[model samples]
Target: MTHIELSVLIPAHNEAGNLPALLDEIALALSGITPVITPVINYEVLVMDDGSSDDTWSLLVQRAQHDKHLRPLRHSHSAGQSTSVWQAAQLARGTWLATLDGDGQNDPADIPALMQAAIDEDAVLVGGHRVVRQDTKLKLLSSRIANNIRRRLLDDDSPDSGCGIKVIRRDAFLSLPYFDHMHRFLPALIHAQGGKCLARPVNHRERGTGQSHYGLGNRLWVGIVDLMGVMWLKRRSRLPALVTGIEDSELLRGESEAVTQAHEESVAAHVVSSRMEALKG
Candidate 1:
């Protein structure tokens, strides 16, 4: 039996105080979940320190030394959460990628359930819907408005794209276009790529340390901008037309070349289409 590798990427800013607890929870969760009909299920926990001003990097490094499966990747400058996730995706060696916030709001115990949902549904992206968010009223209101607007505009059925506890296929994630706030649109992006998305309820907790990074107004503003960008991308996307043919060797080679060429052309066309859509917007 082939072993499946899972990569858990945690994007951190100044989350030193919360890292220890999050790591411990992850360790416990991974230990509890046994693989079915497989000799092994390899997993790695990656903490991407996004130019943290605190001791987050130091703590992550210390943890990595003790645990071979724990990896610490640091960014020289303060990139946003989406970039941190993208960078982690580039370094990840797992077939499946699960993203969680380092601020300790997301429960690591729910990760196993998310992974199971991915397997059961054959879903490319499985997002977490926070059953009880432990955020301030202002933040919650802002998120609610943003999520509603996003769902209406993007037609993505996900209830909470901001939950920050999502499991996705590594290849599907890497294929999406990288943007500053792309993390909030994973389900829509996955759907754009002809992939399936499922939303599962998960637990949300309050932050143990540090203040909220963005205020309600800023969160709403940024989300609006990103929503427009995603809508444009969705409108311009085009899927290839299906074709059927004989299984001759020469025909297969020719067909393969044609398919490759078509894919390249499609990508180029999408780029052009995206630019045009942006201009129209």
Candidate 2:
């Protein structure tokens, strides 16, 4: 497949009611974008069905037969949002990745601006921050608390990591650890890999159809464990400096040469020993 300029990834679980309209909106918005960098703006819209018992996968298949831009994937079991997105990310042919919620709450129109912001800031990741959420107070409060706790623990410097819409480099997303809820820590993942993330305000809308599939009501402790795991990964990670001295470079080169020379000497000694044994025999 040809490399796409942008891949819009959506992880859906029983979003058949919302997928059609969301796909249409995404198509129109993608069509409207005038590529300033590349002459051609080739993009694909990927929707991964997380083993939805509903007709979500069927709808995606139907859409793909007609819409060339629509790429569909289905999981045999219900993987979490992060895993679904990760699976789609692997299939994404685009150099840049754009992700949004499948529930129709994330505005696809904000994606263009988010891409622009990432370019302007020269950042590896651009995250959407929902300035005005259209959810219930309880949901909003839960998300806020989660975001705050995540920010404090991960120190990702992003105010709204839970926002579903995000634009990031494909390479950066690919480098992230494949774990549940890793999508909620993109900024931190990029930061850990010596890349920066720029946050931009985005429009949030109410879901038009179907209830939310997942919530963190009883999974608070699970989230804490995830947080600790991410923190551990970040702490254990070793990122190379952008520039290093000649001494350091030479040291690495010398070590490599030494190892190669030792291997060669060992091989030669083994050959001589084998030859001597043959002569004695």
Candidate 3:
């Protein structure tokens, strides 16, 4: 019943260690404790427990009881992060949507900054580019390579598509074509809709707990296939801009008549000039 302007979406799978602290940090950030920001951010934290085989669901239910801002949704089976996000988008009631990793590597503090960027730039999608990556060298290398490839191929101009922190206008996000890993291709997808994708450099933290559900192979090969698929979609996609207003139509008609009248007058003047020349001759 508390008015929700922003929906903070976190997709988790066996992320019991991260959620408690992440929720608290989000509360602190939204609590208006930061003197730089006003305490006007109204939001709800919707955690999609993606079929956690652990006590993640139980912990979330317990936490939800005490935290009025928290909302817990569960899937009976383990669905991937992309599915969780797509489903959460359908259920989100906020005017704006913000998504961050459940692993807590993405700072909740950055949410406010991204939200401001979303408003400032009139952004349909605001993606966080991690400035400092606190991960293994392997992860850093893989992510760098992936991002370069994605940017070059898609021409989306996004430096960090894999960064889990992104803010978007909920309606705009829902308008995009959905697929299994559509989360990774949001910038390009939004671009296809003639929507703006704003990028903000944000803080990235090291994972305190929970191993990555993704392996190196999961990060690279599958992404390539998905990237190719999205490229195909971009080639095939076209959106129509339709406006229905009698005033606009009438204005267009009036402009057309004016042009026609001017052309007719020019033709008449040319004929009169020719007749005058003939008479003189």
Candidate 4:
């Protein structure tokens, strides 16, 4: 199979109304991107239906018939966003993966630019930072507080850790440890794994069809425990040493000389045996 350069993964639960338009926007966005690795933009779209009771699955199936790039995945029950992204990462066949929210608030047009940023910066992860958030004042306040607390505790240096749109290398993503709500700490986790994380300004839009899935209950309150766990992981994590070159040693040189002498002796013996056999013949 031909390798895909990029995999666009969207995790949606009860986002039936938002996905149709989102998918279309993704297709349009991907069409214009000119990747450095491939002549044409080789990409696939994997949308995970996290056990939505709505018509999400059916819509995906219908869209797949028309769009070959669209590949829909599902869970029997509603798994959280982290699990959905985790499962999709395992299945995605791409050098890099681009993720977006299913609620249509994350602009698909920004995906190409982010992907380019990842390549240009040689970053394993390029996170989207929403400069002008189009959310309620309450939502904005809650998110600001959470981000500040997370930045101080985790020391991830991310301006917007909760932003959903991001481009990540598939291999780097798979190396990180997984847990519930891990998606929110991707920049920190990626940094912990010794991968470069860049935050780029992205366009954030207001929700179009359905209400926001997250609130103070699920967004802020539940995240407290997850935040503590991530902090522990960060403290315990260590980056790998930068290896310059293999060191030459006297013992290795001696071993190499011995192997060379043994091979020469074996060839000399073979030549003698061949001469003897020819004389006999």
Best by lDDT: 4
Candidate 4 yields a Cα-based lDDT of: 0.79
Clashing residue pairs in candidate 1 are: none
C-alpha lDDT values of all predictions: 0.78, 0.76, 0.78, 0.79
Q: Please report how far candidate 2 places residue 106 from its true position, in Å.
A: 0.3
User: RMSD of candidate 4 to the true fold?
Assistant: 18.4
lDDT of 2 by residue, 1-281 (tens): 35467889999998989989999998877785554444446788889887799999889888899998988877776767886787677667776899999999999888888887888887888898888899877677677777778889887689888789999977677766566677877788888778878888999999989887656653345666667777777776575422222433222211120113344345346545643543343
Give per-candidate clash totals. Answer: 0, 0, 0, 0
Question: Model 4 clash pairs?
Answer: none
Q: How much lDDT does candidate 1 score?
A: 0.78
Cα-based RMSD of candidate 3? 18.4
Stronger candidate by TM-score (1 vs 2): 1
lDDT of model number 2: 0.76
On residues 211-260, what C-alpha lDDT tens digit does candidate 1 reach at each position?
87878766898889878888877777563322223433232111120113
User: How large is the C-alpha RMSD of every model relative to the true structure?
Assistant: 7.9, 13.9, 18.4, 18.4
> How far does residue 231 in candidate 1 sit from its true spot (Å)?
0.8
- Tens digits of per-residue lDDT for model 3 on 1-281? 44567889899999999989999999987888892245677778889888798889999989988998887887766667886786677667677789988999999898888888878877788999988888888788777787788989988798888889999877777677656677889988888777788888999998979798876688877788677777777776575422223433222211120113344345346545643543343
